[model samples]
Target chain A: MRFDLEIKCKKIVGGRTKGKLLLSKKPINFLGMVNTQSGEITNTSNGFERQNLKGKILVFPNSIGSSVGAYTIYSLKSNNVAPNGIICTNNVDITTASGCAISNIPLAFIDNQRYNDLVNCIKILGKNKEIEITLDTEEGKIIID
Target chain B: MHLTRDEEKGLSGEYGEATSAAYRILVAIGEATDAEKLVPIKWAHVSGVNYNTIGDSGLEFLREISKDGKVRVNTSLNPMGFDRENLPELSPEFIEKQFEIARAYEKIGVIPTFSCIPYEILPIPQEGTQVSFAESSAAVLANSHLNIITNKESALSALASALTGKSPYSDLRIDENRSPMVEIVNETDLENELDYGLLGYFTGKTIQKSCTGICNISENTDMWSLKSLAAGIGTSGSCGMFQPKKPSKFIEKVNYGKREMNETRDELNTSEDGQLITFGSPQLGIEEISKIQTLMDGKKFTKPCKIFCPKSVFCKAKQYGIIDSLQKSGVDFISDACTCLTPLINKKNYDSIITNSVKASYYMKTSNKVSVALKSLKSIIKGYTV
Candidate 1:
């Protein structure tokens, strides 16, 4: 997944990349599942149970569940167990978006045709230690370099 | 964006630091929704339950700030299941801590009437009534069905809006935001609360990211059915907005729909397989529990059944020996938190669960990989268990 990337957010500030990218084809609900304080996927039924985001790009279709899901994301960030960047098939839910804005997590939504191709490439790249994500708001594309 | 002068003044700290904190939170929330101004509100409904995800820290912070002065507002709250009745005979120290938290809110004029369906106690806002509500499920119902205006405010922002009686004019406050994006047409006969629960699940699963309005409902819908639908939708999707066009006809619709759906599925309906019948995903209120006791007085469970309710109501039931009699009849009564959200139980233990709550059925579908049947409490006791 060596390509250019663009990002769109309320605001964007550069931060260090800490880990690999964990992708989920489905949306993730955090209310009863994720432990906000510990940043552990305490939810046994969650698709990403026991998976650590520490420094990974958490890719998901979108966020599901309560408005508190946003707060949980912030808790994860405060606990130093947040995704480095988020790549979503669509816009994150308002609650999760608010959490990302508050926590300053880099997020990019892919709405372009290239998204399908990019997703396939990213999956093949698997979880990497050092991958860069860029978002092009005008093009509605997220590039992984 | 569309802020009233009063809201602007509060945000600018004309009221006080506590109000200022609330204002900041509201402003952030308003900005998130791309709202330009604020709207005046009459009532404020707050979320009081401690779901570990929201944490106790936010509540603690609000309490600490409110200790300095009164909040100058009228407010209600979503119930927290914990209460003296539920956890009776606790240490004085524990009681003191709980009182301290309550006192903080009391100082700010928060009436701690622990309930989510405040409309049951307080008057529901009339159509186009602008109010500030926090709880997502309630907010959606109030805004969509009642045609009341309330932004899906964040926890602190809801408190701030309540204090000032104003919120940033946004999607919910504006008339245009009330438009239904997704119209859910019930093609099948939705005869009961369980059917509505299933309908809500199916709708949420299908139409993600859209506010749904259930239209053309069969005449059999009831309050319990609608509430179940709301609960299921709330759990299955991010939809906090739902308006049943003819809410007044809900009960009639549920009755009709239940009979039709059940009648159609009769061949598929099985006998009482001795599975557990659980209630109160949102925690049964006192009235609901009393109704259950009355219904179960002469009945014995053919199979094992468990009723989970808020600890507060559970205590009253215990004092009245309703708990004992129910337990003696093989119906285990447990209280604390909602069992629907409780991860302590194994899903594989039960062949199926029968519940009256639409919210429980919705969550169970996702949480438990089993056949969860919905039936009225009356039906359950009568052995017409699905």
Candidate 2:
């Protein structure tokens, strides 16, 4: 099923475009060991075991756990392991928003009525190096490159 | 943005290298919140601790900034995950680095409290009180639980705030931001302090993005239980800030149990007859120490136990003749920052631990796997095992 989804997020800092896309299917926990620089879930539970997102667009449902989660994102950006962009199914969690704002990681929120279906459709999109994320909000539509 | 003359001078790089860094940090934070001007602050808590656990560069940076001893400011410090004095088994180089970092902070007037729960040692600000705090958990707790006004100031901003006694008026300093957006209703009757932790988890899961205040806490709520709940909520959500209903006598009893459970979790054992007792995991206040002394005046300890308290408190107890009385009862009073953080426990050491604080219990679980039975100080002094 093909459908269009759009969202709006406060632009954090932008990063250099790398050639790989590491996407996360499940929601990410801010407290768990996610190597911010490597974009890899280094020491996490079984759910996030072996997940690495270096140079990929991070697609998750939301951020879970800890106010420091926001700072950790910035830490990852500083270390250069941060994702090129982020696309969330819903409104970005506060920590994620703060991190994105602080790190200048491009963010887009997609409003798909059936988010699960859209996630499945976009599953292949995360494997690519360069892809545009169209963010639609009342303010305007911003095409993040 | 309107800045005081000093702030303007600092921003203009008139105050040398370190002050310039502080000024830039404050300006960035102000810009983020769109704050028009910076306000004067009285005290500040600084972060960026360099120890075995932190980055070497961060530690070096802190050392450089703190070397001058010219920074005469009232400042609190964040916790360093690694403690060289406490953990002697670690690497020698790591320990040396930690001592160097500690010395730097001490030179800069940052008391080596090194506790995340600074409110336990530092005084809570009154209503309309403005201070610069960097630790997020403490900031949320102080603002939401204690009704104080503080921003989650950056590490550099906290230093600047301490130097100038002012911060940008934003976020937590504002009144409207402190109000609870979400109200949590306790569906079940919470009996033990652990139940409070579970409830906090539940609230964080249910409330999503909104700030919450938990209502309908049972009359038997204590500091340990509240601290446990707060920590759990903090782990579960971005921040944990809740105001609980005032606790009753029963709640105080539960609080003591939480503390004992925390202290005895790893160091001692509790049989059906033996109760592992703990003191000063939360670093007992003077009032609590006095009360404990009064209760132990003529009591005898039938079981081997440990009393975890601060060096300052232990000295005070020694000065007041309370330490003599405690020693007579076979209770070993140990001066340590955090007993729960200690890795000196064996499986056969104790069957159970009795504690009054919830933070002790929660953190102890990381190293020791034992049953923790929590009770009140009154019960412990009465020679009752919980």
Candidate 3:
């Protein structure tokens, strides 16, 4: 079944972006968890280990460690290996927000109340088919097939 | 977010690239947090100086802004990866990279304090003074102990404030957000710094994201104990300033038991046969230096033990003759950085480490990739007596 789900983005940066959805239930620490040079996820415990976030839509709950994680995200952009778009399901801290703003990466976030539902939906949405995100519009939505 | 015409111009790139970049960052962060307007900040203490952690991308960003723009307000930098002068055994390549990072910050008009405890040299902001601080312990300390207003800003946010002399009006800076959301009942009497630290760790783990009110503290509580709590909570969980009052009108109330504190203490303790004993996680002050010197007097140690403190206090130690005698006892000093934040972690691999800080124990597991045996300073210092 194909579905069109609308994500009520509380905050948006860089208008619109689209890419295949890559989701992680665990929070990320950009400093060590991400390889800025290649845009690959490094932290093994998160299950996305060695997976490249480049040209993908990176989704997660919130930031787990250091404020320096923001620069890691910025480095991803500067090196031309950044995620096409980002969606954090909790408070968009200055670290993640600044990373998106400085790098011109599109970012959208869901509030805590609806964050869990979105996580479950993404897990199910990524089961068999591909998913894409388009954040250019004021409304943040994902097209699922 | 509302912006004045001047701020609008800064956003429009009329104020040059540096100001425009910094302005755009602040406005974005402010908008994310639902901030209404911008406010001037008196101080900015930024972290993420460890080049080994942030790598080349961070260097690129720092140099890009610092080459043309200077900091607008007083600023302090956090620790770097290596001690370029004292730690001569480090690779020259690593030393050059560390120097590059330092120069980038210096060019931006940041004081090369390189200490996590920025309050050591920078004057503590008076109560209710708006400030932009990034280091977790420093943020909590400025808010709870020193009565200064701050939100836990990111490295970039703090850097932006350093360049622009302002931050978006946000959570902790607002007066209404200062009220406690949780009242923590603490009947247990904390005897030592470790106890205070464990309690703080417990508070952070228990009340994950609330402004907690802690009560039943002794009147004799000093800044050292407060620092232990602040550092513990900062590292363990994302907690903001804690009010020192008893149970009050708050949404949630949590009771801290001695059993839970003991469990945490046990969890933190590793092998007693530690390869190295490290002190000064947050960088020791003059009083701590004097205390350690007093304990190490006329004694010899066997383990490769070192105490970390900033250069400011290192000078104080030398002036007090604390370093000379301690050096004779086989103790080395790491000046200009804290042990946890420095790149020494990756270089110095160990089977086990002994430290007096719960915060140190937490960070060591991540930063150094090793476990730590949590000990009281008195116990660790006394164990070295020959």
Candidate 4:
């Protein structure tokens, strides 16, 4: 398939899906920062505050705070409100990896260089336009629009 | 990552649904962390037990996994919401949900110790043994003091380890990563466990390494002080381990002097006084309880005081008549519960709480929404028990 942009990433959890990218510039602590019932980002300090993570490919720098954050991710899935996929711009911490693993959410990690390219593309394309991100594990690439 | 045939089978669902799920989780984490393979672990101390922490979603997953999952290794549990025998005046809904979580873990064949300090009650494996511990304080202690290997596992990863007896051979488990990347020197004179806790909190917040070497700590620092240090670092940052060694020639260096110590103390101590006094965050072992008993010296607490510890420790204390003696002084000994995230101390009933544990203070302020009057155990005993 042809794509406007493709970034190489190390796959943490294997699967393929496409969704609008929801970027979080800061690290997230899912336990308290997210409303598990609705999969809404409750942390007001983060840019994506009050944003529902239901169908977006939630991208973040990292995951921090309590280990219970992993369970919160699982909670998001069990509530039918999890993101289609998660892509970390940095290392995939235990909280993100384990949560994505148990919940079966496709997880991938992009290096700093590729992440910058993705960010610049988003900036040029504008945030108002929906940017579909495809986590193609079989091809080991994150295809973006 | 490469996988053995057995692991491959487990991942492919040949070994059953639960094992397949466990293998999948391990493989995913292993690959993410660049682990070539999985290593066998002897124990797994899992967290995510508190109904307050995990909520309905965690409960749902636990129930589903427990249907076919049984631990392959010796597994212990973290503290639940409240004491099972002496249930607090919580909502019936909470009690029911908490019990459901308990049943799920029990069904999955965990030890159900409901104590975070599993090293205290359980027989610790020989030195250099690998284990998966989700409790932060316990993970720190296992690495720093017990000479065990772990990566400060999350609740789900530890649970997966318990199910499969395997962990990703990366992070802290790698021998090269065990050494400190930074050196934290204590430039201030320490007085009590509270001081040690502050020093640890400072190191944890400042140092950006997997482990650090702490210098100038007395060789004879008590267990309470070490426990406080472990609790402090575990709460403040992601650094899972520390060593009480002198600064090496290489690596970055930071000093934990009075300024840093006072800053940490100010950060955690939010209240002037608290209605309740709690003794444990990493649950009180017999040593701490014995020290408290000695300090109490038959003096009654001026206010409500509770000591959270393991049921095994409580039993031992009772056997030694220490619990009975402490009870006479109006100190409620709560077993199978912890000070952190305990529903027993809530904003509705108590405006604040006093504890020596920075870890407990952090959780009480953030999660429980109650202010904390953090103090040294000695000071608390002297001031409140008179």
> For model 2, what is the alpha-carbon lDDT of residue A119?
44
Report the CAPRI category for model 2. incorrect
The fraction of correct interface contacts reproduced by each prediction comes to: 0.22, 0.11, 0.55, 0.57
Order of the predicted models by TM-score, top scorer first: 4, 3, 1, 2
Lowest lDDT block of 10, candidate 4 chain B: B201-210
Model 3: residues with Cα > 4 Å off, grouped in runs: A20-26, A32-56, A78-82, A123-138, A142-145, B187-189, B208-210, B262-272
Best lDDT among the predictions, by candidate number: 4
- Chain B TM-score, all predictions listed: 0.72, 0.67, 0.94, 0.98
TM-score of 4: 0.91
Q: TM-scores for all candidates?
A: 0.73, 0.66, 0.91, 0.91
Candidate 1: DockQ? Answer: 0.29
TM-score of 1: 0.73
lDDT comparison, 1 vs 2, better candidate? 1
Give per-residue CA lDDT, model 3, range B189-295, as digits (tens): 78878888888878866664536788877756876788888877766555667878856754577877888887878766755657788887777888877887777
RMSD (Å) of each candidate, 1 decimal: 6.6, 7.8, 2.8, 2.9
DockQ sort, best first: 3, 4, 1, 2
Candidate 2 segments exceeding 4 Å error: A1-9, A12-47, A53-145, B1-14, B27-37, B47-52, B67-73, B79-87, B152-168, B218-222, B245-309, B320-336, B339-386
iRMS values in order, in angstroms? Answer: 4.0, 5.6, 2.1, 1.7
